[model samples]
Target chain A: MYSYSDFDEAFVRSRVAQFTDQVARRLDGSLSEDEFRPLRLMNGLYLQLHAYMLRVAIPYGTLSPRQMRQLAFIADTWDKGYGHFTTRQNIQFNWPKLPDAPAILGALADVEMHAIQTSGNTVRNVTADHFAGATADEIDDPRPYAELLRQWSTDHPEFQFLPRKFKIAITGSPVTAP
Target chain B: MTKAHDIGLRMVRNAGGEPGFEVIVGGGLGRTPMIGTTVRDFLPVADLLPYVEAVLSVYNTLGRRDNKYKARIKITVHETGKAEISRMIEDRFAELRPLFGGGDQAVLADIRTAFAPPAFRDAPVAAHDAFYRADPVFRSWADTNLAAHRNAQYAIVTISLKAHGQTPGDATSDQMRIIADLAERYGHSDLRISHEQNVILPHVHKSDLPVLHAALVKAGLGTANVGLLSDIIACPGMDYCALATARSIPVAQELATHFEALKLEHDIGPLKIKISGCINACGHHHVGHIGILGLDRAGVENYQITLGGDGTETAVIGEKTGPGFAYDEIVPAIERILRAYLALRTDPGETFLQAYRRVGLGPFKTALYGEIGQKDAA
Candidate 1:
């Protein structure tokens, strides 16, 4: 599991504070849903049919036990005691309040995780073969390349308006483009 | 996604399951998606990055980005035509190919180790029957979902996400942690996501089935319906998908519910039902034995069915079966088709795809919607 550097830590905390402010305004009705939709989505918050669904990005589906425990905590506190891991390697809580998402994001930031770019037609969590690190049939660890892509695609201006949500699944060098 | 073998190159399969050092390129997903025509079969390791650049340059220039629906590697290959793309790739390949031309030896020079499958003990077949022994629940699930691995002592495992009436591919945070631990303990700490949106422990020792099953059961990943009718592939639809005209997740749930109610999933023997929010086909509707693509009719969600599609080593895009059905009528429509497959299939050995190929879609369509025509041609 990769630990967050100092820079990664600050970046996440900043993003959390930013989202926390946004959530406060939205809950206070100072900000409209129309304006907040993308913001919330970027933060992996969704107003689903039954309740709010908060999707937490796992960043290429990699997680340490500590991070996993934090997720369990979120599921217990803000959700229905469970979370859904989506096809994109992200987790979704079927229940959460509109006002609680920022706190969830804040918790995720503490774990060096965030929901940024998990949604909204941007280069999604740079998916890779789940067998990247330990697969008997891979080149180098695909995570580094996936990480490279994460940096490259983060708030990537050029790909902002891709025709569709572009999902790039890199693999062990060139051997398996899983 | 590039596959080295498809490009006319060849290499020895490693003692482990992987092929010798090389690269494959040009695969993508979506409506016009392709499995990517393999550009180079087996090239040396060093040529990887440069060759990838060549392929991307071609795709970047030629791939259709205009039509949101058609902008995928498959569409590009289809429109540009494989022959031309091969030539362009070959031409570009010559200059860039050498970078990776150095082969497996180069990998030794680097810190990364070569990839290979482990040696298996090739144990005498355990009365696999012992696995099923008598627990009908586990029996049915293991029969439907478990896949045999090449290693006599190992099996490829699919952890199904379908829970009947629930979102198909959704995994809870707890589920993730449990599965991760399972991978670390039972599997090789390696997991792969199947195109069907299921998680796969690609290498599970056969002896560990019971222990693995118990852990998975606790985690809710032990549904044991890997290739069965209940194991469906569906895209997030109108609920969250902005590109969707109709909802797919709900429709998938309804069908799964219906199938569960009937208790026909495992007994149905290897049937795949893929549903997509729209023709963008994220759920891989094109590959389902009974494919359902959601349609919006008068602001209401309807579904169009397709037959004979498969996603595998032998892949075929599905064909439409006449008109679409309203939301209420869709599940029953699926039931009608499944019945047709059941009544028509030769035996349990004949899967839905095989049966479809043998008898074709006409009989099934006629059984559901009345005969406009009848022919066995797939």
Candidate 2:
């Protein structure tokens, strides 16, 4: 439900443009595999087992209908015809190619989404109870806080180079007896 | 169920009736599973960002950087002890709190407005009632897949991605569009992806149930196994992940297909079968009712089973059964455990988890290895 502001849009589009150049450099051999690895990871591209995998963040597990449709389009047009949703509330395109990474990110930016910090050593996607706003047992929706954390953690200079990936989760509901 | 994250925050009300959090820290699964420790009894909602920052800063500085496996905040908490870590976090929080300058609070206020609840329709529930009465199939699907919404006239629908024998969490592009369409048409355009790897239409009016059910049935997304055995949570494992030791997808597929063929999942009731390809525990195998961890035993794929693990608010790490089964042997091992459960449970009302908790692991262990070992010896 949260639409991206101009600042958010500009930030994502710039990241897309920067990654596009980084990808081109890698392909042209100006950037070696070692040099390109961290650059690609910062943008949520990973060299998976069979092919390159791109993890797209679904912040707090929330998606707009338009965003969902765009993800469907990406799945059909780019990699394989499907995407795998992980336990961390993100989606993975398993067979994306190196050349298509930039375009994939660009498509994501159009929907006000990105793969930034999805796979990095820095703070990853902030997750919350999927039934945050709708469930009967909720104290308050935690997604706003999760979104705030997402904003704070994304490219935060101090946490950009943590020892390993960090995960944060919030729940608005206390456990209820079945 | 936020118990298995590096930082897990549960919304709570303090004595003054102000919204705050029960802040938990250092919880994770992987090879060494740990339930988080409550670092703060109740932290004010306004101080959340600063407190969290303090925790992370403490961990980032003191957390082991030398060993990748031991670098998590859980390991840090284990080595540093809870009291010391708590003291350091409090000290850091004292410093960080002033620096925030209410900037995070200002941003949070703006973010909160974006999460306004969808306009719910107060429609008659005649269609849903009639369908439930007339169609047993719809009734079954509705019973399993639907959760109670805050608005009584609405329901939260979890569309099963784990249709029998298919890849558990993989949704085809068409499936995505179908869900997207349903969300737009009937669910107020809000969609959620559950940690259990299912798509959720969080606010579907009861009047729209029949039409939504019809669409899902036509799309093959209408499997009525939400918390059932076939609704497995499996990691990518060796099939897609570079870190996996053995294939997880095939094992999950086999188990789902196997139980579906037996036609006993509904009867068995509420069993979580989570599989991880390696000790990394990405599948959250440590907290499953039946946890299967796949490993490379002398270059051969071997599967180890852990019993009675729970991932609920009362989280508990699972206990391993003796020895590992080979890839071909894993499915039958699961079959043995379930069959034994069927014979041993007091009544059908007893779910797999309740039964396991009641009888403990003795019966299931006997079923899995004892008879097979005797037969092999003979």
Candidate 3:
């Protein structure tokens, strides 16, 4: 439901282009695997057992129909015909090729989505009660603040690197309610 | 916070028109699983940030750094004890309290303003009832997927991602689109991703349930198995996760298919079977009613069972059920446990948990290993 501003769009597009160049460099032997590892991880790319896995963020688990259709298109075009929705509310493409990573990210950017902070030591996606606005017992919806937290934490200088990966979850419901 | 060090903090607005939080410290699951201890019954909401700072500071400074496994805050709490941690946090809170001049209230007010619920409309319930009566499939789906909403004309619908025999917590791109469309048209544009790996349409009008269900059915997303055995929670084990020692998805798929074919899922009532690839408990096997933890025993996939674990308000870690079973033997082992439960239960009204609690694990163990014991004796 949250649309990206021009700045946000520019930021993501630039990152995609940057990663595409990096992938090319890695393929051409200009950058070693060790050099490219952290860069790829920051973009939510992982070398899993069988193939490269790409995790795309579904911010606070909210998506419009347009975004959903775009994701469907990505699944059909790039990876397998389906995507695995993770426990964290993100989607994982298990069979992505290294060369297609940039294209996948560019497609995500078209829908105001990204894989940034879905991996690496920085704060992962900020999760909240999926029933934030709809629950009967909740004092308030927690997503607006979750969105605020997301904006604040995304690429924040202070938390760029940490001793461990951090996760934050918000729920407006009382302890006994859920 | 429950997994890491720091604390599992729960905040609620009290009758006195102020928010307060209950702090639980030291709870974690892995090799050394422990439920958090309640260190503070309640702390003023205003002091939350400062208190959290204090807790994190303690963990950051003193938590284990040498061994990656032992670095979580839970281990630190285990080493130092809750009382000592509480004292340290309280002392730090006192020092930090003066810095916060009640600015949190304004920020909280702004946040509350942003989260206001949408305007609800009065809708005729007769339309929903008529649809329910006309379509048996719709009726069954409504019975399982729908929950009571605050508004009389509204219902909360849970879109179960765990379709029978499919990978748990996976939604196809088309399924996702259908859910999105339903949310926009009927659910006030609100969708929720449950921790149990399901999509939720939080505020749908009762009048719209029929059309929504029809759309979901068309998309292959309508699975009337919420909280059923088929609605299993499983992690991507050996098939996907590099850290996995055994396959969790295939085991879940097999069990789901097996149970569905037997048609015993609905009769069994609400049962949570969580499967983890390993001891990390990513599938939350520690808290499942029937917890299955996969392990590699001598190059063979072995699944160990844990009974009586619950993740609700009355949380309890599951107890192990002797030696682990091989990959093929796991499903039959589960069937044996369920059969024993069906035989032992007082009535259909008694759930698996109730029966398990009433009779304890002795009979279930007998059901699982009884024939093997007799065979060995012979």
Chain A TM-score for each of the predictions: 0.91, 0.97, 0.96
**C-alpha DockQ of every model:** 0.18, 0.79, 0.43
10 residues in a row with least lDDT, candidate 3 chain B: B1-10
User: Which of the predicted structures, 1 or 3, would earn the higher DockQ when compared with the native?
Assistant: 3
Q: Tell me the TM-score of each prediction against the true structure.
A: 0.73, 0.97, 0.90
- The ten-residue window of minimal lDDT in model 2 chain B covers B369-378
lDDT tens digits, residue span B122-212, model 2: 7799877887899999999988899988899998999999999899999999999999999999989999999999999999999899889
lDDT of 1 by residue, B1-378 (tens): 222111111133444555433333344445554554655455443444455446555655666667855754556666787689877877777876665455423433332222234344455436555766856767756665566554557767778888777788776767867877887776765565544567777677777777788788877777866667777878777876667888888888888888888988876877778888887776778767888889778888878898987654355668788788888898888888888888888887788788889887678879778754334322
Alpha carbon deviation, residue B127, candidate 3 (Å): 1.7
- DockQ for model 1? 0.18
Q: Largest lDDT belongs to which candidate?
A: 2
Report the Cα lDDT for residue B28, model 1: 47
A best-first ranking of the candidates according to their DockQ comes to 2, 3, 1
RMSD of 2: 1.9
Q: List model 2 lDDT by residue over A90-137, tens digit each.
A: 999999999999999999998999999987678999988888888898
Question: How high is the CA lDDT of each candidate model?
Answer: 0.67, 0.90, 0.79
